[model samples]
Target: MELTAALRGQTIQNRVREVGINPNHWYPVAWAHQLPPGRVIPVVVWQQSIAVYRDTAGQVHAIEDACPHKGVELHLGEVHGDRLVCPYHGWEFDRSGQCVHIPYFPPDQKLPCATALSYPAQERYGIIWVFPGDPQLADSRPILEVPEYDDHNCLMIPITGVFNAHFSICNENTMDVFHGFLHKDLQGWFDPVLLNLQDSNSSVQANYRVSYKGTLSKFLGLSTNSDGVTTRNVSVHYQYPHYHSTMEGVSSLYLMRLPVGPNQTRSFSLLFLPKVRLPKWLLRAIKPVLVPLVLRFIFMPFLEQDVGMMESEQRTYQKDAKRRYVEVNPAIIALQRLILRQYEQFMQQSSQSNPANPASQPPFESWQDQSSNSSIEPLTVPHSGKGQ
Candidate 1:
């Protein structure tokens, strides 16, 4: 559905900051290349601890991080052939997370049924994606497509990020183009104006027209030179847990989000700069070096500043959850609405479908209200081996 692109002060929804992920989509867990064959990589998606391992044939599988026997972390185990061997005992679990072997078991005794939770996992765009939702819906949904992946003119740079903020806050930071002021010293874009905005139950898309005039903008091919003023249209599209933004035709960014918990988030991003691509052979030869360098020098600075501000916002929010905040960006308001709506939908479905499942909605009454109290339990982040 279409939404008005006009910028106006809209009422803010504080609940968006208090909700959780729907867990019904393909979320990035780790970089595929980082998880080598015959190795285990533990990650989390919305608090679901998963141990991702690649088999001998280079196939990825995601299983419950905890062993069913003694609750040992499966990532501490080893990968042999297509099965993951539990370290505590010689139990072997297959790709389906089924315990198929016990080294000490008698030949006449049937293997005791043991199965760990498994998720539908796959690889694309040099990243590992896991479907944390219903396994039945795995094949029906697809990862966000990046057409530039096959284009030779684009130099694809895969970047990873860890943010000390809620996924909603991180997402809002992405939808907000007006924050360019924060990057002024770095020669970031300026004079931002929201060009268009649209939203739905599952997504929000926005476009902004901004002026660029600085070395950093020129380096990104956004302007002709650092001294000259160049106006460009930047479009940001958020298809729920993932993002695809483009700066005219110069470059594109695909940010896949890993919402580990309420306050911690990680991102697997691919930055494609069509302007940076050179001769095919030379580009291919130096890409290994060039990609990391550009990501470090050109991108990390902006991200560091953004992360600082995001963490600051989260800290403030934690202190006063009931604090009324003012926002001028209509796009941000729309994005917040979408975030809150998704959580509400998930809550609604979970209530109606899983009446008997007690562990559906988070335990709200027993815990102190974060909005009312300053302190709460630290967020749980399994994949990154960090606690929020």
Candidate 2:
């Protein structure tokens, strides 16, 4: 549904910060290059720990991190041929997570009915993706597309962000373009006006008209002159588990969010910018050096500032879980609603599938019954003109 672009104060729900991920989507666990052939690495999606490894033949597989026998971490073990070997007692598990052999067992003896849970995994766009939810749903849900991954004319910089904050907080940072005030020293865009906003069962899209000036703006093709202001439209789209944002033809960002747990989140982002006015061949030849330079000198500074604010928000939220806050951006409210709704949907489906056990649903009491008479005192945005 389309939402009004007008900024209006709305009560913030603490439940948005308390909700968990749906886990029905594919999440990027690690960079594809991190696990070369014959190597294994440990990764976590939500709270589930997984061991991801590449077989000698170059196929990626993901299985429960714990060995079924003695409960040892499978990542500490080695890969033998296409199977993962348990460090303790040399138990061998195939890609299907079935225990096929025990080193000391007799050749004619039947193996125990031991099997570790395995997850659907694949490699794409230099990312190792794992499906942590219902395996049956894996085939239906496709990974987010990134056309720029194969575009040679764009200088693609892979950025890794480790934030000590909830996925919701990290996501809000991406959708809140007004926070550009935080990067003003870096010549980030300012004078923002929300142009469009849309929300769906699983996504939130927001567009803003923002102005920029200074040398950084000229270097990024945003302005013709260093001293002149340039206005551009920036669009941010949050499609459940991932994000894709773009600024006209200047840049594109595809962020794959990994919610490790309630208190931590990681992002695997591919930032693509138009290559400098140089030969494609020359750009390709110098990409090895150029990518890191841009990542360090240009991106990291901005990321560091974002991380600081995100972590601070988390820390403050932690101190007072029920502290009410006011949010002016309708886009942020839409995003929060989507987050809460997705989690509720996932839990409801899980409850239906296993009615006896019944997954616990989030307590959205205050959020569901929000009104002016609520007891929680709402904190308004500070008027100090400081970057919040």
Candidate 3:
């Protein structure tokens, strides 16, 4: 549904900082290239620990990280053909997580019914993804499509971000374009105005008009003149556990989030930029060297600043869980609502299916109170002539 693009004070939902992820979506665990054939690596989705391994046949599979027999971490084991052999006892498990062999067992003996839970796993866009929810829902949910993944003409740079914050906090940083004030020194966009807003049960989309001026802005095609301001529209779309944002034909970002735990988050992002005007062959030749240079110089600085802010926010939130703050961006409010809604929906479905499982209940009681508190001081927006 459409939401007004107005900037007005709203109480920041303290509960948003306490909510957990809806794991029904696919989450990136690692870059596919990082896990070679015959290697096993450990990963986590929400709190589900998984061991992902690539077999000699080059197929990827994921199973519970612990060995069923002795509770040893399976990642410490080695891959033998299509099976993962536990390093401690040589117990072998297949892709389906069933114990297929125990080397010391008699030739005709029956093996114990030892099985570790396995998850649906696959690869797309050079990333390994694992489904940590209902197995039946895996096939129905599709990974976010990126048309630019195959567009060789665009310069694509893969970036990894680790933030000491909740996924919701990391997400808010992406949706809150007004935070450009934090990046003003880096020639970031300013004078922001939310042009459009759309919110749904699973997604939030926001378009913002922002102005930029500086030599860096000119070189990035964000400004026509180095000294004059240039205005452009940026669209940010949050689809449950992932994000895709674009800057008016100049750049596109596909960010896949990994909620490792409540206090930690990781992102695998593919940033695509228009190729510099040059001969096709030369562009291709320099791309190897150019991608790293662009990442180290241009993108890292912006990310570093963002990381600092996000981590600081998390530290403060951790110190005082119930401290109330004020937010003016409708887009951020919409984003927070979507995050809470998705998690609640997941919990509801889980409760209906397994009513007796207390694990299906909401993680905390405080975030459930949506009503405003009268005792706390409302955060006051600073009147610094900057967009709030």
Candidate 4:
């Protein structure tokens, strides 16, 4: 269904702030390079803690962070060959989360029916993605496509963002191009006007005509001269679990959000600039140094500013959920409505099915949890243990 693009002064539902994610898609969990071979890194998708490990062969795997036996955190364990070995009792679990070994058990003894929940895991575009929803749907959902990733003429800046706000807040920040005023001192953009807006069941696209001037503008390849202002179209597309926004191709950002819990969210993003295209071999050689420089000197400042504002919104929302709010941007209101509706849909499905052990779907509260899991016990291993 297509939604109309009309800005109005309308109040929105506060429940949007509490909405959950549709877990039926694969979400990027960790930086590909960060999880080295033979090492395990713990991550959380929704509230479920997962132990992501790479075997000696550099293959990535994600299993429920908690061990099936004794409820110890599987992340505290180590990766042996292709299996994860529980630190508590040396119980070994394969990539499928099946316990394949128990050192104390005699040979030929059937391993206890102990298996940690495993997610559908894959590696792409230098990141690890896991399906946090129905295992059956993993194969059908598609990951965001980026053709620029391999193109040499593009300068890619990989960025990591940690937000103390809900995913909805973070998402709103991305959709609202009018917030460029927040970066005025840095010469972000000015005179923003929504030129077009369209939405569908899977996406909300907002295009704005905005003027840019100053050093930041020049650095972003927005204008040939800093003293002159250039008007361009900034289109932001909220594609369900991830985002892809482009400023007339001068810069492109792909924001993959990971909803950690109610109060926090994380983003793994890749910013591609077509202006800096170089040869493939040469670009590969310089990417290590260039990627960080652009991220630190160029992108981080904007992200930091956005984070401050996002956190502020979250803090205030926490203080008063009933506070009346005013909204003018039709795109923003539509965005909020779509968010709330998705969650409501998920909740409706969950309520109608009432399946035994149903896992959460979205709207954050609809589906019941079907997986057998446990809570994380802080200090499960000795506090003085290695790497503590």
Best by lDDT: 2
lDDT of 3: 0.87
Q: Model 1 clash pairs?
A: 43-383
The residue ranges of model 1 lying beyond 4 angstroms of the native Cα positions read 223-227, 358-388
lDDT of each: 0.81, 0.87, 0.87, 0.80
Q: Which candidate would rank higher by lDDT, 1 or 3?
A: 3
Instruction: Give a tens-digit lDDT track for model 2, residues 1-388.
Output: 8887776667877788888889889999999989999999999988899999999999999999999998999999999999999998899999989999998999999999999999999999999999998899999998999988888899899999999999999999999988887887777777788889998898999998877777676667665444487788999999998999999768899999999988999999999998366679998999999889978987899999999999999999999998999877888888888898888888878878998976543444434624423333433333224221
Q: How close is every model to the real structure, measured as TM-score?
A: 0.90, 0.93, 0.93, 0.88
- Residue 352 in candidate 3, Cα distance off native in Å: 0.7
**Superposition TM-score, candidate 1 onto the true structure:** 0.90
For candidate 1, lDDT tens digit of each residue in 181-266?
78777777777778778878778889888776756666676546344877888999998878999889677999999999888999
Clashes of each: 1, 0, 0, 7
Cα miss at 377, model 3 (Å)?
18
TM-score result, candidate 3 = 0.93
List the candidate 3 regions with Cα displacement exceeding 4 Å.
223-227, 358-362, 365-388
Ranking by lDDT: 2, 3, 1, 4
